[model samples]
Each structure stands twice: as structure tokens, then as C-alpha cells.
Target: MFNQLISFLDKGKIRKIARSHRAERYVKKFSTYNHVVVMLFTVFEGYHSIREIVLGLLANAHKLQHLGINYVVKRSTLSEANERRISTVFEEIYQDVYNRHQRAFSGQPFKQ
Candidate 1:
């Protein structure tokens, strides 16, 4: 189920955007994919703060690989990425994913 959810994302496109933004400039350990997965996981789980995100990820660290996440991210790293990376990168990914999948929904179409 987790893999299926992530499968919707075009990783190549995401990576291209990340490169264009130079989002990995100061980061050494975590990749852009890691950051996106962490953020998406937090949103899907309704985490309210970074502390909760860290704790939740730590608790599930063992199972993250199943979701294509191999590293246990540090709070500082996640915080830094969140602060430094242009948010438009993720927003673009979201828009791209939504545009690609919107036709599957039966309700009123989403427009962004």
C-alpha cells in the first residue's frame, strides 16, 4: 500500500526539480527523496510538529525501507531542509501528481 502510494510520484521529475533548485546544496546525509517521503508521511499521519514527526519516524525506522526510505533522518537535517529548500519544489510535485491522477476520481475535478 505504501509503495503503491509513492509509485504515483514521478521520482525523475522530482529529482529534476530538486536539482534545478539546488535543494541539496548543504545536505550530506539525506536526499531529496528522503525529505519528501518524510514530509508526506507526516502529513498522512497528521503529525503537528517536527518533534512528532521525528518521534514517529524513529518509532517506525525499522519499517521505512519498505517505503523506499533507508535512512533514519535527524531532526536537525529535516529542519534544515524544511527551512532552506524552496517549497515550490514539493508544491510542483504535488500539482504534477494530482494532474496525472485526477481523472481517476469520480467527484468534481480538482483545479489548481
Candidate 2:
């Protein structure tokens, strides 16, 4: 969801996604790695694909900004970004979330 992205991007470096001089495409710096970052996040969060994410946005299309992306990202683009970018960093971020949860609950476990 684009609304969720507002918070997610705010708390993450995706706010700094890079674009090439030759193209309007927003290429996350690690290339294929970036694809994996998005793919994994979507999957882990229970989304099936970029299409699902895009469909979510389309449902709330009136609220989305002028992204110039009128359609779902092609599977090829998804595959290419996954193949070309550095996704391990994203996996680490996901792992860190689990680690933080562990720490929060293991020692001074919340009273609730």
C-alpha cells in the first residue's frame, strides 16, 4: 500500500532510491538486490507478487502520487532487478526485525 510505503520508506533507506541519468526508472542502487528486497518484503508480509502490491495501489489509485507507472511492474523487470541488485542487505533488515523482537521479549518482557 502506498500509504504504508509512506511510513516504510520514511523509516528505511528506500527513501533514497536512485534513478539513472538515461531513464526515468527508479532503480534501487543494488539493482537485482533491490528487487529481492521488495520481493521478500512483499512475500513475508503475505503479498503474492508485485502485481498484488500494484493492485492494492490501483484500488486506492486516487490517493497515489504521479508515479508515471500506470500498470503493474512486468515480471521481467522484477526478475531483472532481483538478478542485478544487492538483495542480501534487505534480508538482513528483515532478520534484524526478528532479532529486535527476540530481544524485546526475552529479557524484560513486556507486561502486556
Candidate 3:
């Protein structure tokens, strides 16, 4: 179910935007995909801190690959990425996803 939900994300589009933004220049292991997944996972699980997210992800590290997150993230790595990476890539992805999915929720409870 979770995998199917995440499958809706256009990874090609997200990666192209991330490349344009140079979001993965320094990190070899942590790609934009991993970063976004960790963030979305944090939001979905309601993790309040990077430490909590990292710990939770680590505990479920083996399952990350199934969700298309190829690597286990470290707290320091997530912190560095958050501090240095431009947010526009994710913003663009978010807009794209919302635009694509908005129609599916037409009768659902949402402003749009």
C-alpha cells in the first residue's frame, strides 16, 4: 500500500529538478530520492525531529529499499542536506503531485 502510494511520485521529474538544482553534488550515497522519502516518511509518521526520523528509519532500514529509498539516511546527512539543498526541487515535485492527484479527491474533504 505504501509502495503503491509512493509510486505515484514522478522520480524522473524529481531527479531532473534535483540535478538542475545541484542537490546531490556532495553526497554520493544520499540521492534526492532518499532525501524526499525520508522527509515524506517523517511527515507520514509524524516524527518531530531529525533524530527521531533517523532512528525510526534505521529501525526500518531494511524496508526502505522496498519504498524506493535506496539508502539508509544518517541524522547528520539529513541535517546537512536540509541546510544546504535548495527546496525548490521538492516544491516543484509537490506541485506536480498535487496537480496530478487533486482530481482524485474532488469529492473528498479539501479546499481544492
List the lowest-lDDT window of 10 residues for candidate 1.
Answer: 103-112
| Ranking of all candidate structures by their lDDT, best first | 1, 3, 2
- Mark the 10 consecutive residues where model 3 has the least summed lDDT: 103-112
Best by lDDT: 1
RMSD of 2: 7.8
Question: In the order shown, what is each candidate's alpha-carbon RMSD?
Answer: 1.5, 7.8, 2.4
Model 3 RMSD in Å is 2.4
> Which residue ranges in model 3 land beyond 4 Å of their true spot?
107-112
Report the Cα lDDT for residue 91, model 1. 84
Clashing pairs in 2: 30-85, 30-86, 31-85, 32-81, 32-82, 32-84, 32-85, 33-85, 33-86, 33-87
Candidate 2 runs further than 4 Å off? 1-6, 15-41, 49-71, 92-112
Report the C-alpha lDDT of model 3 over 3-93, residue by residue, as the tens digit. 7668778889888878888887898788887788788889888999989998899888899878887767778888999988887888877
lDDT of each: 0.84, 0.44, 0.82
Clashes of 2: 10
Superposition error at 82 for model 1 (Å): 0.5
Model 1, position 83, has a per-residue lDDT of: 93
For model 1, what is the error of residue 66's alpha carbon versus the real structure, in angstroms, after optimal superposition? 1.8
Would you list the rank order by TM-score, best first? 1, 3, 2
Off by over 4 Å in 1: none
Model 2 Cα lDDT, one tens digit per residue, 1-112: 5334323322233323322212224563324223433454466457776677556545645543333233345555665665554545454544544455655435664331
